[model samples]
Target: MVGAVHSLGGQEIPLRDPADFLSLVQRGPSYLVREWLFLAYAVFAVGEGVGLYYLTRPARSIALWALVAFSAGILIGIVQDAAVVAFVRQFPSDYAAADAMTRRALEPLARTVVAIIDVQQAVANVLLGVGGALYSVAILRTGVASRWFGLLGVPAAVASVFFGVVTAAAPRLSELQAVAEYAFGLVVLWDLGAAIVMLGFRDDARQDGHANSPRHRGDRPAA
Candidate 1:
């Protein structure tokens, strides 16, 4: 739960420094709260993907792919979150009581865990970007939401994937990783916008021969 730029007092803790990471892990309750929130987000994202697939059913294949991508990302994220939570709960106290030599031995293991988490999170971000892009295309093709709304997601998705790749390729770019964190906000905003459009403008889809916006066009009865 510690950020890319977490500072203890005036000292900024470098990312994945075992000593600092172990120190922060002692704040187990805080870490648990953050991880639980992440879990909640993962659940919400999956539900949202299902709803989007339903709404954009005219683009059935695209929507289905989008849903798959999102769900896959969420699955990886859940595993990553669970790993950190388990590590925090089980290891910090032991690290605290361990002798210097024991701590040295544990540092490599701790760093490996952090590396794994970084890669998992990066892959998750890339998958989320792919999902967002696909879903945006579905929205555009189906006329289920404003074109501008769909357009907004394209660049955001690109930025997300770009930074995600950078993070995975070079985990040392903490600044870019921080930017990557903000990049997700754009995806979140798109989700909020899409929800509002779905709720408030459900009837709008009917204007452009999109009466089947929420249903597959092929399902319509012949006149």
Candidate 2:
């Protein structure tokens, strides 16, 4: 039976068998849900990249390159999701049998699949970093986006680089790999929040400009 264990977080968690932990952590419903969530975000990021490319006409070259890179990155994410699904589906239930099965039937295949995904992910991360850097440059040069938003892009690009490096060095420094993943996730959430804030700020500025214009002054009768 599973038992309750205390974690470093000062929270009690259920301690299950190794097989159960593997299933829950790597191959269970939670992992599946995360994969689907990643797919959804990939869709949003691709759409946003397309919209940015069209809206920022003055930075067309940079926008276009960023679009291409983001699109490639999303494609790689999709492929990785597929591999993860496959791996999870093949995971065995019994720990002892699972080890044997993995070694005999799944390990080699899973390793190869993981290797391909890792390489693709590394390329994707580099492309993502380049795209973010280009976007930041475009934002700064055009003065269309907020400076703070542009600044956030720098760390996002750095995180992308870290992701690529950590992924390539995985299994050796697995702890660092986990940290990199968490850092990337946080950066993405921060970037999304920044975009929302920038949109609001831009709209407010536009409204203020219209209200202050002389054309609007004549529309209002004398007090």
Candidate 3:
């Protein structure tokens, strides 16, 4: 299967036999690394949601709702990643007749797994879209961060919408699924960069200090 995937992409990689799948599970640490990364991002997103909830209070109830939505989105993302990893780990190899038989035996289960992934992906995208819109509005109204951060929301929302459309049309254009996956990865990278910037930078002028920091708000005069 790995060789077939590589051939499709003009690369070469050894295909794991079905019997080797257990060994791959034991030997390969890449899956663990990927899971760690997904968990790390999920934690970061939760932190951001918490921060946003605190920062956007006293004026708009929307921010609080956004925080909840974003947290849910992050949770969904984590689940989706885990599900994908699980699916990969369980995929039967096409190298041997035994593997083919195993795959046939698991076909029903595989379909169920795919269905769950599809549903989770749809939920994640919708939540992300809602969260992005809410965060953009929060930034605009409160001026709690650079408006440039809000620009990130545009692509994020578009990607969410595109993902839904592409996924729905996946059956019609199976070959284009790879392209959709690539596009989604690009958008995720963009979002991760934006999140890092938002969390790291301290643009005092753009921040709603009074709203974000209670102690500082009472101590300093509003600009």
**What tens-digit string does per-residue lDDT give for candidate 3 at 1-223?**
2323323231111133444444434433444344455556665666666766665664377787787787887788778867766655445332222455776565556556666676676677678768766876776687766676666666666666566565555456556666665666645764675556556554543476546675755666457
The TM-score values for the models, in the order shown, are 0.77, 0.69, 0.64
Candidate 1 error regions (>4 Å) = 1-15, 198-223
State residue 174's C-alpha deviation in candidate 1, in Å.
3.4
True-structure RMSD, every candidate: 6.5, 6.9, 7.1
Compared with the true structure, what per-residue lDDT tens digits does model 2 show for residues 33-134?
454555566666765565555545478788778777767876776676666555544443332356554545544554566677777777777777777777
Candidates 2 and 3 compared by lDDT, better number: 2
Q: By descending lDDT, how would the candidates be arranged?
A: 1, 2, 3
Ten residues in sequence with the least summed lDDT for candidate 1:
4-13
Cα error, candidate 2, residue 109 (Å): 1.8
lDDT of 2 at 9: 16
Q: Global lDDT for candidate 2?
A: 0.61
Per-residue lDDT over 86-112 for candidate 1, one digit per residue giving the tens place of the 0 to 100 score: 766666777788888998888778777
lDDT of 1 at 158: 87
Sliding window of 10 residues with minimal summed lDDT for model 3: 6-15
* Clash number by candidate, in order: 0, 0, 0
Best by lDDT: 1
